[model samples]
Target chain A: METLFSEMQGALVVMPSGRLDTNTAPEAEKMLVDRIKGGMNQVVIDFTKTDYISSAGLRVILKAAKLLKGSSGKIALCNANAQIFEVLELSGFLTLLTHSDNLETALGIVGNPA
Target chain B: MTFRTILNAAFPPFSEARRTKPREMLFSVAEKPGIGTTFTVSLQHTLIVLTMVVYTVIIGKEIGLTDAALRGFVALEIVVMGLTTLLQSLPTRFGSGHLIVHTPSVISMAAFIAVANSFGIGAAAGGILLSGVVVIFFSGLLPRFRSLFPVEVIGILLVLLGLTLVEGGVQRFTGLHEGSFDTPTLLTASVTLGVIIAFSVWSPGRLRVFAVLAGVIAGMIVAYLSGLFGASQMAVVSSEPAFAFPLGNYQIPAPTLIIAAALPQLLIEVISAVDSIGTAVTIDKIDDARWTRPDMQMVGRTITAHGAGLVLNGLTGTPPLGTSSANLGLVAVTGVASRIVGTATGIMLVVLAFLPQVSAFITTIPRPVIGALIVYTAGYLMVVGMELILSRLLNSRRQFMVGLGITVGVSLMVMPELATGVPGHLKPILGSALIMGVVTAAVLNQIFRIGISQTARIELSGYSAAHDAAEFLEDRGAAWGARRDVISRAGITVGEVLEVLHNEHMVEGTVNLQATFDEYRLMLLLDYRGKAFKFAGDQTLDLAAFLEGDEDEDDLALDAAMSQMSGALIQNLADKVSSSSQKERAGLRMEFSH
Candidate 1:
């Protein structure tokens, strides 16, 4: 998985392409953690280009959610396909996180003050 | 096994299984359905599916998924299976429109288990999803990869898969989980096998349809009588609800595991797709008088739907689905391959999915009974593999490759110590005998390609057959160094032959094309089980009709004129065109030079 970082409304928007699993999770986790540590606590992961996600990928987002919560930060997931959304729902991540159908909606969630 | 032995042992007769002449079909694809007959036949199909649904339960237990999760997963799996069957049975561009039942595939279980064990269930789920994507891609570029898998390789894989399942089944029978090899369990298995064999051979008409169910019931009776069941097992019947909606829990898979496990999964998917296609082709041969190869468009689409089904399985946390050859065999035995019956079967499954109580009841079947069923299915699988190997001319070279592949696979599978020397990560591939066999067969297949002709073969079906065949020829010809004009000419010639065949009342799904490319020329051999094509010797081109023709000319007239023109064009384009027919197999051989 390769993440292309962009900013909208001062919130970092990360778009991941290809797969988000064990092979790519480490790089993705480090990138997200580094940004959170660097004080860019507001994040949105765009999954439009990413077609696959496994448990290893889920753990990264879970960790990020936990990390951001301690610092009063927010994370929003956007553009998840049916498979990804179902995975998130089954894993109980949907209850713990906020999701939007598109970047515009996601940015609104991430832009709000905690 | 020898070819004769396989034929004799197809389903192993207790009293010489009487050969039922392939039943005459009561309904054709185009025939309208009767409510009573549709319901009756559909019920039979439903029974077969119910027997197969045990796969999901076994797989769920094997993977250590929670009970609730398993139930929900099975619910979704049943629904997907129904929808897939409906898609396949419908007269769609991508479906075979045959009574092909889609269910959780036993062949892929070994790979799924390996992935689950190595990474996690989530990773296995991810791998299943990835496999779906891979299949969709494979559907598009089928010809290029077609050579990689032969009947011999698939045969090895199938036999290995059967052995693996049989091993699992025997372990279950011996109560390895409970660490016992008691008399009760032994009696239960024996009775189940006995009842199924008795019903299959001695039962009359529709009673044969209930053989599997009856056998399981009989085994359960024996288990209960033998005091195998406890109050705890029976108590769940009342506690379970009558109905519940399917709610899938989610677990994202590991990418590394998905990638690592992809090779084995992809191989399994390819075999499943090919097997399903073969089944569809066999049905086509039986259903139509002018049988061509299976419709490639429909076959490809059906495969894509199957892939989509797998993705659904992953999203729902269920095992991957494969086409059930047992159902295909049912279609043959029962002679009711109607789409309406398939639709009814699908609806029945969807209804059953919502009935949690029914699922709860199925769970009560003794482990030994399930083990017996698995063993029976595995026996059929082994025979199916041997039949596939024997389908083609098995030269000594092929015999050696098959022997080597099987020996290597079984050795690795039977003896775990052989894989112990391998590293941890690679164990998924090296550890399992099925994967080992698959890799071996695929590698040897590639290596033994030296003496084989450099040819590409594709099965084309439906109205799109001509177009896809044309495109395939042009694409493959270009890849083999044919000039643009030569490729174009070759494509046109192939299209023309198909058009001529169509004109002769050839149904859309019966054309197979094999093209061999050499330095100087491209030799295309087309086969179909239909009326032989011969160009009309007389050319009656009406210049007056052409001159007087208006834009409002009848479409029928224009079609007739164009059809006639195609024959002449084919003659002009190809240097030599000849056709021959032996028995029911018709061949059109055309040679196009650069």
Candidate 2:
């Protein structure tokens, strides 16, 4: 698995490719926590390339959401496949974060693009 | 342990152990009653079997046989009934090892009369011989066509059999003598029915086993007092010889095979075999508390015995024999289903054939009394048939199969003229409600099975994922003709697995659900790009501790608890559960026995 980070509308966009399971979750968590600590708070995780998620991967996203919430910054997720979306809905994670079917709507949820 | 100690441990003493009987049965199929109990029960069955000899009498009269010839024919029938009944109760290659009594078949009576009318008694005998061979041949093939006679189809056969008896039962009960209601006959029938119901329901211990006998004796007394049993009926009994050989005076005719006579008889024999199947199923179900499906092997043995009886009938120039449904009802009501009773009854029948006067006296049983017995048996059969039908998971296809099958059968019963326009030879198939109903149900069952695939697929995702997965399995299960209980379990297991997959964030793409079903088992496969579920050995969840835990720990505790619950539910619901993962893709398989 590979984690791709980019900037869109002043928001950090983190795209995870392949599976976001136990083997890759720790690395994804480390990268997100380091960026948030460096004062990049407004974020959107794009899951267009990611096809699987486990409880470990869910914990990584939950930790990032908690950190952003403490900083009073918004975080959103976009482009998650049906399985990932179902997982988020069933786990009660959707209550803490905003999500959209596409990246543009997700970026708008975090901050308006220029 | 030593060998002696180990052997003693494995096998308990008889005094320390008790064999469990089915709740409905007093004496099970394997249990043997004492001589006194056996004799009385056998006598009750013998009375019921004797009443069916009126069909033989009718056929004899129709065929214009001499009075002495008619007596010989009736004697031959009684002998065949006895031998076949005895054969059916024995646990041999030919017998079903159940209490299946044999009697002259009303279907064969009609076919024989037709053949006799067209050709002669010699040709009729030859036709019966051919039909017997065909019946035995068909018995071998019936087990292969097990899928055709599903529970619902057998239900239709049973219901039709009950319905067919209603015309005669109600007529005799109402005492429609000379197109007028006879008060005496009605009173006698009511008393007979009343005593039977009372003894069956309220009587205690050994008294209950003699319920039918009590009812018959009471009915006979009522008939004698009401002038229904006059000196004229007694005269007929007195005129019969005290003891005579079956073939002493009557001459045997050389049977000549005729295609015109044998073809219709062969067709009717096939339908009669269907009746034997229903009887076999009824007796099998009565014997076992946890009967899941028809024991086709035993059923084949039953038909084999029935065919053997027909073969004997052919050689002796008598009417073909069938498994008696009335005796089955008697067994159920009296709670005595011992095969020994069957043996005793058969012996009594053969003994009665020699004592012609005794058999004549039994035939003098009032029509109303016989009617009451038929009504009781009809009620029992119809209820049992309905239970069998409801035992299956019915979709629209199955509903139509059962509904239309019954409608066709009942239609012929209500409108006898429906077969009047058909050719004379086809009347046997189309005229009889039992034959038409079973044929329609079997054919419709095959027709409705056209588009139903054994395997089905659906994509399950989103908030209603679990619900959607359950519904998909149910619909497909019904279409594949799976048992209701098995299908329901499958649905519940799939729902539980889906909940786990969704709640644990286990899948990242749509979960593709695929189901495959054969008669014996159902298999479900779920594939998705996801993490394999981690089923922890420990399933116990500390609800109290989780409730009192810190908020951060509470969420983690709930997640662990839900995963444990999912694993436990999946394990209990399915016969087998297996999971496999390759790289990023995961698969879960659940199997349920049908």
Candidate 3:
């Protein structure tokens, strides 16, 4: 799996490709934590290219959400396929973090205040 | 726009939903087989159809037509069957564009004879004409009543249709002559049936497609050797003219309206139309592997073609025609369901009508061979019907719906005397096991549907709350006929929510679980006198800080993190979730799209 990182409207956009299961979740978590530590307070994870997610991936997102919240920052997710969205929903990630159907809305959500 | 254009717009040729071809089928509805394959498969279909024409001959003989006139009548019936079969295979406003063959209907034949015996032949034609109109009208209304025919009901119709053929199939297979079995006839039928089965099961590739034909050949040879096809039958075939015009010795009957004859004929035609629904479904299922539900639009078109054929039969002063299930069995055995074959078969039948000698030769095919074919078809229909019924998740209500339906249908077949006291007009509906069983099943389905609410509730208190909740959703899901996967997902989500509520100590006393299901979605509500969950908003637990805990606060931080994880899990499982509170009363609602 490859993870793409870019900047859109001052929010760090992180896109994970293929799967976001246990094998790739550690690398994805480290990248997000590094960006947060580097003062990128606003973040958006776009799942347009991602096809799957497991419980480990969910834990990584939860940890990122917690870290961002401690700094009074916001994180948003977008473009999740049905399977990925189902995982997010079932894991209760949707309740804790903002999500949108597309990247524009996700960026808009994260760029703005709570 | 022209009338045909208007009709096409009203009823499209194909269903809106596309279907995948079944893997078992060698040729599907839209597929075109090679010329040789098409002709060979068409020949098999044509032979099956020729066997069915015995009904036409019987109707003609019963009506006391002279030999010359009877020949013309049979020819006319064959021509109508060919035209209708051709129409049914074409993608026209009237055709279903499926490999549906038409033949003289046994159900309509008895009614036709009864009308002819009571009134004149012209009156019988008039009655047949009326039935044609009624059937066409019913076809338009059939798609609207698709809900009336669930999978199980169609299954019942198919099973009963098979059951109804049992006596005929068995009698011919056993070669029962009067009270005693004919040894030669039994031997011939066994050879034919055995060959067909062997070729179908053991043979590979193209050989399977000609199983029925090979069986016929083998049976005929056995029959000839056993003296079943002696010089008498040979003489009968030789006496027929090599070629002759169908109308040479017969005049079209002048149709005259007779209410007594037309009403009964109309009623019987309506029932026959219902029978065609089963045939259409069988053919539809045979061609498509991803078959979820009946394509009612195509079924309507099938009935339209059927009714139109009856109209032709009326004009031609011949017996009423129906979609042939025996030919459907032939399609199943051959694994070929190409409309091209249907078209070719139609043309062959029409051509054979002008070749009296060929039709006579086909008519001389040993009875045991035809019987073996019917028995093969009967077995296929019964098995396919059972598969259809078992496809759905059956609850007690649906179980009764299928069980009672089959019981009622089988009862009529076993003890036909049950309909002895019924009025003559109602006999068409009540006397026949297929009609009664389907009617009973359809009616009982509606009756059983009553009082079965879309919403159900259960109380969850002790240790089995999660298990009880899953079981509750499962039972209600089956009753609602919801998709099994959706039901399974719903059960899992509900169980997770109940576990969270109990483990988190969010609920104090008994929790009332209410589930509401519609075709589109399922909503689950958990109501209890307990603490409402704090949904994730801006709140976040610093897991790193908690793990590196200042000793005494570690347990509290761990508890908070665990609670947050559980909340996330529950929220993610459902498509939408919300919490409601009034004083000590709290409720959590979760919705899942079906």
Candidate 4:
């Protein structure tokens, strides 16, 4: 699987394919912070197609969550499927990241927010 | 001793700072307690950014889109969305403190929207590829300048950006976007807004992370399960193509909106570079870490990111902006200072680029959802602006001039009709946010005597008078005397050493010096550059010295790279010094040859 992350303004947006487990968590976390240092504060984890995220992913999320709390920005989970949501819930990340069924719902929070 | 050893011996000792692992030090924040801690991404920002994206698309579709493209959009929406969210969630900077903050700097979105709007499903991959180039450039440019950017001006800008989107988001909410407001539309908009706000502001602990998110999800689910409106809403169950060819793409579309808007869009590029660099410097200072200059890497990366974005906009049907403050928020919260994380992000961007399936799904975030996130982002911008204002140490006068001017100028220029009489031909030229910044800076500077661009000169030699030259001077060997120099009042003879006894910039310091009265006078110049200047005796004897003592012990290999244009600048200054009695002092005339 491949994971790509980038930032615009001060937000980190990540795109991860395949399973997010212990093995890839470090890689993912590293990529997340690097893109963020230039200007990423808010992050959107698009999990629409993510098959599963293990406790490893949880660890990564927890780490990221804790990091964001210090700054005044936070993370939001978007595009999670049922399996992904279940996994997030089990791992406790669901509580930390704002979740949307799709990108549209996530988009609703801005200006003339729905 | 070998010649090499002699040359190496000439270099200074290691300044402890270089030995410190910037990367590791950056990452260590998360390891601490109460300082570096991460929280779940705020649903507020998630909704905000996502909503803006959807809103842009909804409005854009009204202007230009086909039914076939809409269907393709839905299918694309399903595939890479998880990747998009994951990508969106990674903190750019590692650390803690930013739990609820978010910034709206989506530069890559421009290329995505452009590609989707113009090329349909064909060019999305190409757009992502192009946009990646832009981001890398931004990373490079963010470290050259220091803490010049604070939230004051930025706060106003954010407010304006959010307010500007009001029309678009409201239109989407009313279904005026599609020319019909059904029950589903109102239900979706209202319930979604209320729920999201509740989650963003009132949610607690881990539950709070998903607060705005929970609201949006619940609102959508309610609409779907309740059969609130469109029958197609239930069609999500339909089994569509699970994946699409993200790479090995086909057909580039015509140079449509994507290509047409590159110039105006570049404004985001330049501003974000400045903003990014400013934020980086602030982070450094806040952490009490080693000083790092915002340099070519940051500036270049930022511009290139925007330029590359042309392709992303051309394909993905997303407006683009240079990611800025959000990363800081991420760092504030996460406290993970791993550049490796950024590497992961870069790799993720690459994955997103090739996987059209991925870009497709990320594009599906709803307009209203993104809209709410936009509010969060704007709020963050305001906070950042405040940070900038404070950092700049803006006093009452400086605050009134810079802050008020930027706010008013930005709002006026941003407003469409305020300058309605402006010719269409000049619209692009005059109607610019960056231009607004420059004007505000200039006008306010004049009133407050904060001249960001007033050249200082001696009646003898013309040069940039040292305003913020402390760093440059310190870097050089001139650690003696505090300030650089003062404006010369007397019209003196040639060969007199121009020592700055009292630099009236920020601090006051003396530059001791003397005189040699040849027709070609001996002038001592001290400007911030590669090398430093030193002076000893009264305004009788002073000399320019290479800042050889500031180098690291191992920096012997890199001393050549330390000074940028100082040699040429010194030479130029020396060359500019001419025989005043002979009527050829270029310093006085600046090559005013007749």
Instruction: List model 1's recovered fraction of native interface contacts, to 2 decimals.
Output: 0.00
Ranked by TM-score, the better of candidates 1 and 2 is: 2
Model 2 Cα interface RMS deviation (Å): 9.4
* lDDT tens per residue, model 4, B409-520: 5666457576568644234335544445544654554455433322222222223222112223222211111111111101111111221212112112332222212111
In the order shown, the chain A TM-scores of the predictions are: 0.95, 0.95, 0.95, 0.80
lDDT tens readout by residue for model 1, B459-486: 9877566567767875665344344456
TM-score of each: 0.54, 0.77, 0.73, 0.42
lDDT of 2 by residue, B1-594 (tens): 897675334321112112346786888888999898889888989999999999998998898888898898888889999999998887766777778999989767778888888888888889888888888777766777899888889988889888989989989888886789889989999999999999999988678788888898889999999998979999999999899987745566667799988888888987898899999999878877767778777787788888888888888888788889999999888888898999888888998899999988988899999999999988889999998888788899999999999999999999999899977766878798889899999999999999888999999888667657767877887787678777766766676677677666889968999999987789999999999866667554443344334535545654565565457656766888889999999999989877
Off by over 4 Å in 4: A1-114, B1-52, B55-205, B221-230, B236-240, B247-250, B254-321, B324-370, B413-415, B422-439, B442-594
Query: Which segments of model 3 are wrong by more than 4 Å?
Result: A1-114, B1-9, B424-426, B455-466, B481-594
Question: Could you say which candidate leads in DockQ?
Answer: 3
* DockQ metric for all predictions: 0.00, 0.02, 0.08, 0.01
Q: Candidate 2 — which residues are off by over 4 angstroms?
A: A1-114, B1-21, B177-180, B531-566, B581-583
Clashing pairs in 2: none
Query: Rank by TM-score, descending?
Result: 2, 3, 1, 4
Pairwise lDDT winner, candidates 3 and 4: 3
TM-score of chain A of 2: 0.95
lDDT of each: 0.68, 0.82, 0.83, 0.40
Identify the leading candidate in terms of TM-score: 2
